[model samples]
Target: MHPLFADRPAAGRALAGQLAVYAGRDDVVVLALPRGGVPVAFEVARRLGAGLDVFPVRKLGAPGHAELAMGALAGGGTLVRNDQVIYSLGIGEETIAEVVAAERRELARREDAYRLGRDALDVTGRVVLLIDDGMATGATMYAAVDAVRQRGPAQVVVAVPVASEQACRQMRFVADGVLCLRTPSTFFSVGQYYADFSQTTDDEVRELLRRAVTAG
Candidate 1:
């Protein structure tokens, strides 16, 4: 079995097949972790014919290592930190606070930019399929799941194309369902599995969100 994917869309299409059970349900909504997850979730939302919306999340990247996720912050002011990464890397509360404060600003900015004055979809009593491109440390996805839970989703399913084995294990407990198309034992980063893992621009996210809404 090849774990590689051509890109986020390709991976998303593959991931949607596993979620056929949620197809065409009026009470189902697909919430993507923008801006990367937007593209992936768009395909899923399109396939399932579900309403699509953004659940903004920002990773609290480690100091001096912006690529490394020390934790994450999501909507509803939810934060999930990796204690092992924090304690081992000597990340202090002061530093962590600084990171979260900055990310919260960006998260708010994205929520506004992506929505473009459109109110967020009401997820209460709906089956929320929370989509992200992939999972590595899973801090971001965990934060998302936690935040969504507070909004009273009937079921929160964490769906991704590829993820580390450990990430999948941690998600299953917090999320009502976890569907990962591939769980590679040798996973390092989400980008490694994709052939064309280029950045997803804000404009692209906006366009896709419009298309998804129009398509529905």
Candidate 2:
């Protein structure tokens, strides 16, 4: 086990402990970002006895700096971008359009695969907890929050294992509450803080959701 994530399951367990106050509330729902977030959110939803669902968001990568996200897109065409990054990268309107178009398709495909025939949970006047594996630039998670906010959730809480201090501060402006276990000032990529930062497969995500629904 990596020292940072000595016991992998314990990370989720810790998040559950922090979120215990919200347990057994009918007005609360857990929305996990697919792929990596599913497993972490599974533990949280189970512990909270809250309805679990997926909230998909896709990153619009800069043309040359694919890892560097210029912006993000979420359901219902909620787009959030860092104008400084876009301008600095010299990302033109045409490039942004193309990237967003491609990401929208991918987002739709992921949503279809994850949600299947299950109806999306109504966020109207409900406390919506958004979960992801971790936070980097926070652009993607911000996009998710922006998309969910459109449905008029009573509150928005973002829970994650680790995040940059700056990212956490930025998220505070958007989320009602930000629950982060570790916010290191000398932050690097989120994966660096995880001992077992293996790639999460689509099948794994599907199985996690299936199990959550079955357990419910």
Candidate 3:
């Protein structure tokens, strides 16, 4: 057994195998979380012969504890908060507002940068496969699910190369199906499971999107 995935592309190919049933289906579409998820979804989409698009999501971490996600924001002005975390941490409405505002601006910028004036692909009445590099707390993926749900997809599937067991369980309740290649009991971080988990640059994402569009 290898220590971890060779990289995101390798992980995407692995995921594609598990999702082969959806291959060549017109109603199936792959939605990747920007930055990290694009590369992984690229392979999945290519193998499955499905359309690829980005579903931008921004995590809203606590004011002091940046790693602790209090909620998340997605496109279409949709925001989902973890009320339990908010009440436990005593996060005020004002602080939540501030975080949401900052994330919304960043989300908008990313949408513009990635789409470049093109409209988002329609997910209505489609089988939407949401892909991410991996999930730790899963706040962002949850937000993505919520955003897609609003669009009336026939079904929603959350696919990741690796994720915490707990996060995987939580995601199942939100999505119609969940596909995780690895759920190590001793989960540390998503990057730890990838040999070359480099930071996915904006330019790389833009280039991948370009290739995906051209291939289609």
Best by the lDDT measure: 3
Better of 1 and 2 by TM-score: 1
lDDT of 1 by residue, 111-171 (tens): 9899999999999999999999999989999999999999998999999999999999989
lDDT of 2: 0.87
For model 3, where is the 10-residue window of minimal lDDT? Answer: 1-10
lDDT of each: 0.92, 0.87, 0.93
Runs with alpha carbons beyond 4 Å of true place in candidate 1: 1-3
| Model 3: how far residue 22 lies from native, Å | 0.7
Over 53-141, each residue of candidate 2 has an lDDT whose tens digit, in order, gives: 88988878888887787889999999998898999978789988888889999999998888777888899999999998888899999
Candidate 3 lDDT tens digits, 4-27? 689999999999999999999999
Work out the TM-score per prediction.
0.97, 0.95, 0.95
Q: What would you estimate as the lDDT of candidate 1?
A: 0.92
CA RMSD of each candidate after superposition: 1.3, 1.6, 1.5
- If both were scored by TM-score, which would come out higher, candidate 2 or candidate 3? 3
Cα lDDT, model 3, residue 69: 88
Per-prediction tally of clashes: 0, 0, 0
Off by over 4 Å in 2: 1-3, 6-9
State residue 216's C-alpha deviation in candidate 2, in Å: 1.3
